[model samples]
Target chain A: MTTQTKQRRKQALLHRTGSYGKGLLFMLPWLIGFCAFVVIPIGWSIFMSFNKVKIVPGGFKYEWLGLQNFRDAFLKDNNFPVDLITYFQEMLLMVPIIVIFALMISLMLNQRFPGRFIYRALFFLPVIFATGQVLSELFVQGAGEVPFIQQYNLETIVDQYVGPELAKTVMNVLEKVILILWYSGVQILIFIAGFQTISPTIYEAVRIDGASPWDSFWKITLPASIPFISLNVLYTIIDLFTFPQNPILKYIKENMIKVDTGYGYASAMAWIYFGFIFILIAVVLWLFERTMRTRRGRS
Target chain B: MLLSRLRRITFFDFALVLGFTALAAFMSLPIIFILNHAFKPTNELFLFPPRFFVQNPTFSNFEQLFLHATNATVPFSRYVFNSVVVVTMTLVSVIVVSTMAAYVLAKYRFHFKQIILSMITLSLMFAPETVGIPRYLIISGIHLNNTYLGHVLPALASPIAVFMLVGFISQIPNELLEAAKIDGASHVGIFARIVLPLSVPAIATISIFTFQGVWGDVETSTLFMQDETMRTLAFYVNSLLSGLQNSVAAQNVAAAAGLLMFIPNLIIFLLFQRKVLETMIHSGIK
Candidate 1:
């Protein structure tokens, strides 16, 4: 090679090596944490899923049961299927309600209006107020105020409007779902931000081309916001399972309190639950990827 | 014709704005309802027509909330303390660690770099919730339960934080780093003196969001901090409401407690509203 070419190659090699060293240094913390915490714990749980953990007064012991826990949770534990179904049913309604509301709010916030900032903040405030325990308190206390109503058993107009039957069903279904609206705060903010990022020029172009506001939204805003919508959907799905009031979580907590068992059964059950969630996530991601690819193709 | 077309657009804008305003009001009604109840007398709180405004607003509810904060059973103050410590520690650790990792990822062209970047991005979708049981087991085994380290340490290794910093760091021109390098600056020196200063805004954005996430999270801390005193503000608020549902005043106190727990996040949101909103948008985008 020519002297100039070799000299340039040497410079490139030095620069590359420097960045490599820096990257390795930077990644070390996450690498260490990921291995120590995430990957290993997942492996441990997979292993423990096959075992029965017995905790004596002083220490613990593990014996391989080999799918016994899974069988127990699925075939033996009658409550497991019911809890799983009820939980996903909540997800079915909650996810769509949150996404639609958040999208509508995002559209509104995107407009120029009086008290917009205050409205935005108010909408967002529930995220802070409606945290797990806090919202549970609110739910409990709010439900408590109806004691006299419950005592008198008022069959008032409002009761008829909300309806005792539907309300009870909603409460049953939403045992953990009502508090979920609070989570819309982040999703709303994200959608608004996404809406904001869509260039005004695109809207203007559509307008000049004689497209109506609805048309522009269909053509520009909605299309552009697809990626953000998918993200919010994913976030909502993950968050729904973490509700403290989740029957599965309650079951686990209840198990933890029992004198004989020390998180072994809970661990086994949780792993199964997580395995289902992983499959769901993979499907959702695949669907999102396909949708995006199709959208790109159509464009 | 042009005036008519413009008029149609204006009409559409007006209708759209009005429709959205109505929707916004409906969505915000729950918050407004809660706030109104929080400030009202217990009797008035449940009154017909559901009084939008509180009559004879009292500090009693707030006073009771603060009073409860002192109690050891709830340890509301300790919860707040735990939240502050965990959030602060997590933010600091995420910034330093993610920045170092991101610097290398952004500036380097190493083998396995693409794999590393993709793994981080993919992991962003996997929240702690999915892996909660295992994580709890891990923390329990390590005896990190009920400590600030348990609350804070896992949050530090966010894939999104690294990804965010990579985006910002990549935008930094190579010549700047090369000049420092030619000046006999070591990689660590270049990162500290050169890369760190330039990436302040990105760091600020990451830190604020990370703090918000950790501060507001009750699940992790609730699961880990079996001790009441070790709980974070979110869990304390939950406990207070759960603990006191009978007394009329206690209901009010619960609302106040909810509002109190909301205060720090509200303040953060207000102070760094633009930063938080912007970072959220950026994070959502990628």
Candidate 2:
């Protein structure tokens, strides 16, 4: 290359570095917070999980205990494993239901209609009340439950018709419908947002081509919203797992406060639980990516 | 044929409207139920087949709530003050920090931008509960426990806020920034005068979210603020509910407290619903 071209390239590189430095300077607060809050806390938790953490007169002491804490959580502690399995089972059922419901509702709300914003606001209303304490209190007070289900003796009726095990499962699913619907508020908002991103012209074109609404939904809307569906899946998973109602979190909270099962054991349980969540998220991302790739290839 | 088609369309729209109305009523029932229960007399609360409407509404619940607050050592206003201070501090800091960082991520081409963005995505997957123990450890270790900073600092750097702000700021026209730069605007000057002013809707959206999240939070406040006076209203109400179970007066007070905690959020939502919805759509576009 000519000398002038080389000099121009060098100047461009310098300019890029300068911008990089400026960007890093702007990101200083987050970097500091990430280190102090996230990085350090993660390291500390991992360190503490392998030790026996004791609270004393002033602060606490950590005595090295190797893999005993992990072993205790898996084998010695019955509640942690049961809680973890129950959480996984619940997530397996709830995640798809929440996502599909959100998608369906968003699709319904996305249509051009008068008072659309009112319906949107109505759907999003649960977000205002779906906080940890409020929801728990509402449930405790019997306000949040579907009133007629128990009053009508539906579970017993189902039990008589179906097998006992299936009846129990069906009843559990039925009971969770309200909870699931409430949890879908944000996901519905997200899906509505995603729905809005698809241009109207595509739908118009699909209509002119004689495609039915169902056909257009599958062909155009679903493919276009794949990214958002995955996003909602990740969100629903995280939200469900971390929700105040989660038995695993309740278990962790119970253990964290007690003098007998202080920070070390709780930290160990948390790490194990986090491992499950991480794996779940990874599998979700992988599945979505593969689906998207296949869809792209087909088209 | 045209008349028939128009009639069919109207019928479809009618069905759609009715369906949505029913769903809306179902969604709003809990809020209505809670508000109604707050007004019910002690005898009415236990009425079978549970009336949706209060037959004889009374202010006794509110009076009882106030009485209970007064009987408590710290008083109700203290919890309100604590919530206000912590939420405001966290809001101000989050806006300043997240906005600047978002501007850089959006407007500037930088090394490791992709990495930083991916890191944020990864961080979003980590549940707060998973980190609760270590978070408490850090707060106590830094001697911030029982202080507002302990309550505020851990949540100040919200990844979702940063992500949303980045999307919002990126939508601001580059030509505008270039023109401002040409007029001798420094980075800070451009951010303060141009980006910040143009991004009010986005800022408001984040503010409402941060406010609601911080206001409704109980676990952090409970963990950090051991002192009764420093606890937030949510934590206080939670404690009250647990401590005074089965008493009609306590139940009344709990419902009242729930309404009290909910009112600010409702007002915010009503005021900024448009802006918040617009921002959500815009973020989706990105």
Scored by lDDT, the top model is: 2
Residue B247 displacement (Å), model 2? 4.2
Tell me chain A's TM-score in each of the predictions. 0.79, 0.87
Query: Candidate 2: where is the Cα deviation over 4 Å?
Result: A1-18, A157-169, A197-209, B1-9, B110-115, B247-249
Residues B74-191, model 1: lDDT tens digits: 6566666777777778888888888888888888776778887777765654434445656776788899997888887777677767878887788789999999989999888999
Candidate 2 lDDT score at position A68: 95
User: How accurate locally is residue A159 in candidate 2, as Cα lDDT from 0 to 100?
Assistant: 91
State the lDDT of candidate 2 residue by residue for A185-267, as single tens digits. 88888888777778999999989999999999898999899999998998899888777776787788789778887889898
Give the DockQ (2 decimals) of all models: 0.33, 0.59
CAPRI verdict on model 2? medium
A182: Cα error in model 1, Å:
4.0
Q: For model 1, how does the per-residue alpha-carbon lDDT over A75-101 read when each residue is reduced to its tens digit?
A: 877787778776666567778777887
